[model samples]
Target: MTDFLHLLHHELLLSLVIVCMLILKLADRGRSGSSWSNLLNVLLLINFAGGLLIEAEGSLFDGMFRSNALLHFEKNVLSLGLLLVGLLATPYLRNHKHSAEFHILIASTLLGMFFMLSAGHMLLFYVGLELATIPLAALAAFNLNRGESSEAGAKLILSSAFSSAFLLLGISFVYGTCGSLQFEQIALTVSGNPLQLLAFTLVFTGFAFKLSIVPFHFWTADVYQGAPIPVAAYLSVISKAAVTLVFISVLYSVFGALQATWTPYLLITALLTIITGNLFAMRQDNIKRFLAFSSIAQVGFILTGILGANVDSEGIVLYFLLIYLFSNLAAFGVAGLISAATGKESILDYRGLHASNPRLAWTLTIALFSLAGVPPTAGFFGKLFLLTSGASLGNYLFIGIAALNMVVSMYYYLRIVKAMFMETTAQPIGKIPTGVAPAIALALCIAGILVSGLSGSFYEHIHLLTLSY
Candidate 1:
């Protein structure tokens, strides 16, 4: 009972924070009170701090919500991603009319994501997933007056509903077959049978939709193209990271025994996603659509880590994800910052960005290079570890194909860099005050890429975390 209460307390605390924010919104309605943005920043900081403390307190409640060193690390990593997203959204919201509600929705979504990361049962996982997802569709359409934004929202919701149906059906099948929803119990019941295979495939379909893998990724480009930059960043980083964490947990825990059954499928999916994403990205001139496809390609690289047979694969995946979170956010942060300053979101609008806003251009350049897996950055190390792990598994074909994909990916990623540096601008780009929050966030991302590369300890720590579980 004590343990359960402790676990409950953490969940309740996040819920309380959400409710408090709602009440504050109500009180501020019809009046220009203190800037909700300021309050939100403070509240978000506190929420992040609270999540850390809760993670440190570790798991409570029997095995129902156990938090160990690994999960604690993952929670902190995710919280950092959330914080960065919020900071990036600040300048974006400042210029928009409907800013406050947007921040509130993001906060609420982060609360759900926090729970999703620590979920110990299928029920909790599914609930957390939904809680994290539903708000995002609305956020996608926060620009209510824009037809593109509304269409993006509709698409996201429709696709999300489809995925949720698949997930629920899979859950029902698993429950019917295994007679239990707990990961351990389900794993115990799973055998090489048609029902188990069906359950696995069904669940994988839902997760693949979230991960934006091939065949399940048709909505990504349109949504990215239409949604506001901040919302797109939220989807790219926070939401995707949370889902990936759960996906890893599910793969490593519930389906560890079925590796032989699932590895080939995962391998095939990774290759397909890599090829398709890169091919589509190469032809995109719209920055958001380009990034949408780029993110899909990145997911393929992430899949390589999951396919690793090493004991440290989980930790490696998480560490790489952390690097990805920072690199991708920095890229989007620059885009959002630029978009807010100039009403331009297209790649060509960046003509002579280096001359107009050197700081933003250079920051974006570094971010792009990092994403392309250039050296002395966190992204490079992430790819190195993934490749190393894959090579160790003796999957030469997989490693070789991944290497080729990396080369292909560089072509598209470099296109953005080339546009910023080599191209000439027609007009001087105006600089917006990135503010303390976003500046700090960008700095941290840059620092993370550098620090993670310089320090072997970072990788070692991640290795330990993967092994701990």
Candidate 2:
């Protein structure tokens, strides 16, 4: 009871903050309303502080809500991602009318994600996933004036609903097979049953949808192309990370005995995701669509770590996720800034971006290079660790395919770079005044990439986190 209370306390505090923000927005029907930006910053700061407090205490109420070193690390990483999102939101919202509503929705979605990171039971995890997902659909449609935005929202909701059906069905099967919803109990029961194989397949399908693997990834590019850039960035970073964390937790805790059963599926998906995502991305003319395909390919790389499926694999996965968060966020941040500054969404619009906005162009370039797994950046090390782990596990084919994928990926990633640096501009692309907040966000991302590469301790810290509870 005490443990549940503690969990509820933290979860409720965040939920309450979001509710109050929403109410405040609603209450201010008159001309004089509160500054949504200020309210959002405060709310995010409070949530971040609370996450830190939970981390400091090491564990909470009891085992049901415990916070180990690994959870603490993941929580901090998530908080940092939220902070960057907040910083990116401020300028983007300043020009829009329903800024307050947007902030409140983002806050609510983030609140759900916080709970997800520490979720101990299947029911809690499912609730958190839904909470995190439902609001995002609305956010995707926030720019109702835009046709693409509306389409994005509709697609997101539809895709999420499909995934949810799979998730619920999988959960039912697991409960029927194991007679329990707790991960530990499920783990014990999974070791000895033929039915467990089907259950695992169902659960893997749900997660694969979230991860946006091939066949399950048809919705990704369309949604990214249609949604607002900030929302797209949020989906790319926060949503993906949360789902990956949940997938890792389930595999580690509830299905360790079924590793052999699942590895082949993961491998095949990884191979196809890499091939299809890269080939698809190579033909894209829209920047957002290109990135959408790029992200799908990155998910393929992440699966390699999952295939390793050991204590060390957790560290590998976390480190790669951190590197990905920074690299991918920086890429999207720059793209959002450009889109907002110039209402241009297509790759051709950026023909001569370097001539006018050299800083933004270079930032985008660095980000893209990192995405392509170029060396001297965080992504290189991230892919290196993933390959190292897979090779050590004797998954040589997986490693080889990942290596081939990187090479194939480089062609498309470099197309963006070549457009920015090599091509001549039709019209001079002027820079909007880069504010302190967005600049800081970009700097932090760049620093994370550089520091992660230079520091051995970064890898060591992730190694420590990979250990099982």
Candidate 3:
């Protein structure tokens, strides 16, 4: 029992939060939305704090579940993301009728991600993957009155179903060839044979679907467009971060031997993803769809880091993700505020925004700058390291292509900034009041973006965490 408690403290703490949320639902009658939102915020902060303090390093359930310093750090990263999402969402969720249910789904999906981060076996990973995915479909359709929301949900369901099938087939292949489902055992037995290579391909395809890689990203824009802004932010930051952590781990550990086989494929897909995302984003008028494509392009950069196959790769990726969380959420926070206040979701709707909402315009401008990987922001540092890491692979041409895509990304990202700061509009959006919770969230994101890059402390700390790798 002591071993269980020590090894699984993070999971146990989150489970408690989920239960408490369930009980709260029963007694939620007659409660003000502010009170409910406040309570939820408190719980999320507690979980985030607990993740930082908890310490565990071991395998459990016959290696079905595991934990270590690195995994713990990754979990904390995710916890921080959830907390940020909760804080940013408070403004929109407060007074909404289904706010409680929305939070419950969010918490449930978070629990699933926790399981995913700790899984040591294929079956455990699969279960966690499903847990992490299913609730998001409901979240995508959260706007009950919006037909587009329902369409988003149906599309997500179909996409997730197909991905799961591909993943399961991959797992089955591994089991048949390696005669084991445990990652360590698979690593020991995998020989890069044709069958095993095929298995890895299938699994990679599944992850591709989840990560919104090119050719598998058809659902992303629609889903982001239809989902509530907060939910879209969660899907963009938290969901992508979780899968990215797992993808790096699986590729580095269980399939490390097959690196030679998969690197070429990753290279091709990464290029396609960057180009496709950039071109699509340039054509998008909807802010949600624009960010959705931007996120896809970011994935291509993440792949570049992963291709490094060096010690620094994991830390660089994690650091990039940290920067991305702040940068992307900052943009989304501003968008959410505008959408909630004026129902404007178009790039053109932002024309002359600085005239009335200079603060929001500036905040979004800084965010887009970061996303464009411009200097003087954390995103600049993040992309720099990712490119440097990929250069370790000695593929200058590919790295150059990736670098050029960053320039392409800049044009679209700056287009929004131009609209907000320069373009004139007859009917610009009026000044929108950001409530206390959202204001605080935006402040935090801005601080994180500005400070995290200049300090080097965050990157150093991440390096320390990944030392065990």
Candidate 4:
């Protein structure tokens, strides 16, 4: 029992937090939103801290589950991201009627992601994926007051249903071909046979839906525009990070034999996703939608990195995600503050924002700079490593294309910055109050952006952890 507890301490603790939060809700049914937000934030901090303290390395449940330094590191990075989300969203949540429920849903989805990361069996992974996805549809429609939110919810549900069907069908095909669901067994048995190839394609389609890869990304912008800012932030950062973690693991391990088969396909999709995302983002007026397409472009770079198949590829991807967590969330944090206070979501509304809201203007500027992969920001290093890793495959042409798309991304990202600092509007957004929680969140994100790139130790730590995986 003690061994089980030690090995699964992160999961156990998170589950306990969920249950305790539920019991508290039952015990005090009328608690205010601010009160609930405070409690949730404190519990999330504890959960993250507990994850750090309880590290174990082993397989359990007959290898249906596993753990190691690398998986632990992934979970910790996710926990930290969620912690930041919870903190950044506090300003919006404090007055929301269902603040406790919102955090609960986010936490539940995070638990699902945990299982997805640790699953040793295909069925376990599928189960975890479903758990992670279902709650998000509800979250997308969380703003019951808005019809667009309901539409976002419907679109997400339909998309998730189709993707899940494809995933299950693919898993079935793998089972039929290999006669086992265990990742290790399948990894050992998988071949580049026609059936296995078809199966991998189906599975890749499912991941494409989750990652918001080009064609499968139609629902993203609408969902982001409709959902509450916090939910949008969670979906953009936490959800994408989780899927990317599992996607890389499955591709690099279970489908290793099919590398020759998938590389060209991945290259094509990466190029298209980056180009398509950048082109679409330039035309978006809504901030959420713009970021949505921007995230799609970011995933393109991630797909490029996965082509490396080198030992350090996983660590590089993880490091990029860490940088993304800070950079993307900072952008959303500022947007949320502005939206909540001014009820403005248009890029044009931000014109001359610096004249009145200089702090937010600068925060968003730094975030945009990071997202555009501008130098001196962690994002620059993140993209450099990813592109470099992809270059290891000797596909310099593809890598070069991906690198050029970065310049395209910069134009759109800077459009927002230009509106904020350079352009002027007669009725520019006035000074908005930054609450304690959001202030801390934005400050942490800024610090992360500035300090992480300059410090080599963070990447070194991640690289060391990935050595075992």
Candidate 5:
């Protein structure tokens, strides 16, 4: 137990916190209004800062578990995002019947994500993957009063089952080829063999499902639309961030031996994903579904960094997500506020939003501009760095297609901005009573996006992290 405590410092903190929350829930038993949420929120913020402060970096648990510069950086960034996400989620979760349980589940998911980020072996990765997934289904179905929530949970479970099956098949094949489940063993053993080829193909397909890459992306839009706003936000940012790190780590570290075999494939899939995701997002009326498709489009940009697989590209990818965490969450944060106040979820309902609630309108405007990759905003820098890094390796065609997708994406992202500022409706949602927690969350997101963008030191810090790993 002492060994576990020292080795997985943050994960242990999370585990203990979850237990404490569960006990608190039981103690509160059937209370009309539970204040445990406020306590949990404060505790979680402390955990996030403490997790960031811990500099202990090593491998333990027989080398199956590891924590290094890479893992530490990933955890810290994810913790910061979750800290803000928790703040944003609070307003919506306050009235939940099982609010304490919801926090417990979120902590469990984050614990699993930590495990996944640092898994040294295939079996360890699988364990972490499933742990991260199970709680999301329950969270998606949390609003049991709504039929769409139930349907979203069903779709998520079904897709997760398929992904797991594919992942297991890949694992078994790779194990048979290498006679070991350790990533180092596989890296040393794998070559251009048919078995290695088959294994990586299957494994990447599972990753594609999680990242919502093309062909495996059918479930993304509906799930995002139906789940509770906070759950949708969780899936949008947290799940994607953790999965992005693990997926690239596997491919970049273990299967790098097959780059010639995989690079072209990544490029093709990226092209298709960019085109499909942007096209789909253009037609969406629902706000969450629009961002869902937008997330898919953004993944195409992120994949380019993975395709390059260099220190600079790695830094660029992580930096992009740092700002992306803020930009995307800001948009969702505004959406949550509007939803809470007006109970309106459609883009059309956002018409003339500026007339009454200029704060919400401008907050969302900044977020949308950043997401659209417009100048002086973080999203523009994200795309610029991503394209430059990928293109440096002479990926002109893929870069060209990606640029086109950016143009396509801009049209839809600005659609909401237009609705809020330029258009008007007979029934305009006026003057949402924005609360303190949500207001702070929005400010943090905007600040993150702007500070990261204008500050070259941020890129230097990211470079230092990549060098450490």
Candidate 6:
């Protein structure tokens, strides 16, 4: 009983989501479908709110699972992001018959992320990774009517399978060398032997695939382009953040013993990722694909900080992600809102957008500037902190290379901005209708950006909280 109580946050969220999914599956049919959707939203709201209040204080179940301030913070961030995702999804899902199932699928994926974060053992991490991947493929191809959607889903599943194989092989090697699948046990026993080196490389590759790091990121653009806008939004911010948190967690804790061997690899990967993401993003016309590459570049910066991964750096990592959450989601929300109204997904279609719908134009402008690391916004500070913290560990070369990539990225990020406000077309897209839910979500994201950047106390407080761990 006490053990279960220790996992109150995890258990309650898991149970509530499962029960709601079951209810949606069995009880709701064709009739009163909208009401059922409303109910799902409410239940999800309760689930998110309840997650914040629950006390997940320690390792539970023989230490195979544990909770900490950081994990709880990650969960809370995930919940809030997903809540807004649900709201953004409302307008898009309204017309689809399988809307309820989509919510269930998202809940399922969130469950897997929860497990991934909590897992103290390698087996549980692998289980969580697989659980997160499968449903996401389904969601990628949710629009079965489109050939691109189907193709996206298929590519995702195939990539997921390949990555899982690499992950499992790496685990096998680790187990053979360490004689244990537990993180703490593995950390003590592993060294830079031939087999252990191969294991670490393969495992890092697997994680890189999920984060869509360069060379392993072939599936990113197509999947983003093919998926529905809201699903793309979910994948861009929420899914990637989950993978990043756990990936960094494992690096600092489970594999800290291999730092001498892995640091070079991590730095090289980060540099290449930034270059590839920026160059590719420059060429993308599809908004989703563009953001996909931009996100890849952003990950490189995050990994820059992670190269200097430690207890103190953890706060900076979490802070970078929080501000990133605000900036990225805001951009996606504006894009999603406009696309839903005009059915235009091309960057070329945004000409003279500010002439009518100033809100979207301004929202997008701010978001793009944030992504470009312009001043007075969360992203500028976010990147500043990440670079400085990384350089604090004597990674000046990587920082210089990163500064170059930021310049490359700014050109493309502002390209969309230029199209909307500066350039004019013969027939500009008319004023797009903004839904209430989307409007509220955009407002929330913008406010989050301001508060995160402006409030030094809030910034220090969140950063200091990580020190306690």
Candidates' TM-scores? Answer: 0.95, 0.93, 0.98, 0.99, 0.97, 0.97
* Pairs clashing within candidate 1: 59-67, 352-425
lDDT of 5 by residue, 372-398 (tens): 899898888988998988897797877
Error of 3 at 289 (Å): 0.4
Clashes of each: 2, 0, 0, 0, 0, 0
Candidate 1 — worst ten consecutive residues by lDDT sum?
54-63
lDDT by residue (243-279, candidate 3, tens digit) is 9999998999999999998899788888999999999
lDDT of 6 by residue, 368-393 (tens): 88889998888888898888877877
Give lDDT tens digits, candidate 1, residues 53-121. Answer: 643345544455655667667766776777787787777677466566787788778777767777767
Candidate 4, residues 362-440, lDDT tens digits: the string is 9999999999999989999999999999999898888888999999899999999989889998898888999888899
TM value for model 4: 0.99
Q: After superposition on all CA atoms, what RMSD does each candidate show versus the true structure?
A: 2.0, 2.4, 1.0, 0.9, 1.4, 1.5
| Model 2 lDDT on a 0 to 1 scale | 0.81
Preferred candidate (TM-score higher): 2 or 6: 6
TM-score of 5: 0.97
**What residue runs in model 6 are displaced by over 4 Å at the alpha carbon?**
31-37
Q: Residue 67 in model 6: shift from native, Å?
A: 0.9
* Segments of candidate 3 deviating more than 4 angstroms: none
lDDT of each: 0.81, 0.81, 0.91, 0.91, 0.86, 0.85
